[model samples]
Target: MPAPVLLPPTSYDYVTVHKVQGTTITAASDILAAEEPLEIRLGFGPTGQREHRTLAITMRTPGHDFELAAGFLLTEGIISRRQELHGILYCPDVEKVEERENVVRAELASTVPVALPRLERHFYTSSSCGVCGKTSIEAVQAAACPVLPTDGPYVAAELLHQLPERLRAQQELFEQTGGLHAAALFSPEGELLLLREDVGRHNALDKVIGAALLQEWLPLHQHVLLVSGRVSFELVQKAAVAGIAVLAAVGAPSSLAVQAAHNFGLTVCGFLRQGRYNVYSHPWRIVGAATAGL
Candidate 1:
């Protein structure tokens, strides 16, 4: 007989609760998505003269902290390439043992420049929203994320319909907790490639992008990114920064999110469930559709 395998401590927590369904009351153990504050610090400047700074603190589910940090930096325009990051590790000197895993330090190569003033404007981020403290839409545009290529990687409308089901199947943590959001990457052929889950929608996407970055699979120009929630301006910005051409969500897209997707030349698909979906921008990427009305 094999011993029961346990999930990572930071991924989820179990609580004994009373369940009242209709009229009956039953005590049961419920799993909850774990959310914790992660402080991201940066080490940049020339080799011996390197400087350290606290970049941003975010509340996120703790499983893939390194990927989350790398993705956050890439999407935030802090570091463009994986080579720019020398290494990512947990902070060694912490006041408490528990705090050690909550802090991550990303050391940047000497060639990479650190803009303290620019990075300081948006220092604190919450799990609910990534762009809460952003100054303006103009500031996001100023990040200079390149527009996606217009050529192929077209996906069928039928394939889009099947994505939600495939994504749901692979959501291991979500199945247990039902409280975490997910971000999944699929090939143009609709094959599920990678998936990440987190308490924050943006954090989930960041983890996916971060894992892709660390694996040297970036500039994901030919893939589709699907999120288990509504599309937001921040998600659009992050997708565009990662060079992902297609961004789909299970829910609706905010007006600003659609506008941003249009500006970035990234295709936006929303209301992605059942047998149909709405194409918010760059409809040409989705094949097998009737566009005669347009």
Candidate 2:
């Protein structure tokens, strides 16, 4: 057995004394979120043959760390299914633990090398939005994913407005400091299923996806994924990998995110507040809502 890797302490700052309305007032703040460097390490073999490699570094909350790594591998197109993972463990080196305890390595059971180049379209925290440069519309078309095949049930407008509050209520870490992002899964009836919070928005999404994969509930094309922040291309790609058809966010969706959703035949909605939301991609699935007939 290897030694457990201990991550550094994390806290979010939410209290601030600021002048408001010409008076200094103590207020709840959101800037003091926990930020920690988490390193994902790759591990292989059972004992003496074990090998390790530093995969990617990400800033995120410390909880559910294993799920985050698994999700990252999936979205990167390195491993599509949960069964591919041989084992995930903390590094055994004592010196390595002190210097890089946050580091985690994954070992694939198969001998086939996972190609990172195929993941050029995948976005990690360290990669810029458009680092791949411009591609001809046709070239972009070639990389597009097809629409999800599933029968979607109708969701109501009031249910859409209630999701943010539901997700907020479950964010244990965020409630303490108000500095983390959350990703949640909801049934067609707007019931909350699972929610994960992380310092990095992408990490949160990955955790939720990883959880879904472990439960064999993947290809979530029938359910909905809700985020507490704006939608990004990276988020869209993760959703696409899980076959999630509907992605709703509390903020805005980037141009590339919207394009990615449309390319994948997903329904992208943003600015979900006060019973109103803007649908960016396919809207036909949201039946019975005021915007459904439109």
Best by TM-score: 1
Provide the TM-score for each candidate, comma-separated.
Answer: 0.93, 0.79
Tens digits of per-residue lDDT, candidate 1, 21-104, equal: 999999999999998999988989996898888888898888889999999889888888889989999999889999999999
- Please provide, for model 2 over 190-258, each residue's C-alpha lDDT reduced to its tens digit, 9 standing for 90 to 100: 778888888778888988888887787876867889999999887887788777888999999988788
Residue pairs with backbone overlap in model 1: none
Error in Å for residue 106 of model 2: 1.0
- lDDT for position 72 in model 1: 88
Model 2 lDDT on a 0 to 1 scale: 0.71
Cα RMSD (angstroms) for every candidate in the order listed: 3.4, 5.8
Off by over 4 Å in 2: 1-31, 44-51, 94-100, 116-147, 291-294
Q: In lDDT terms, which candidate is top? A: 1
- TM-score, candidate number 2: 0.79
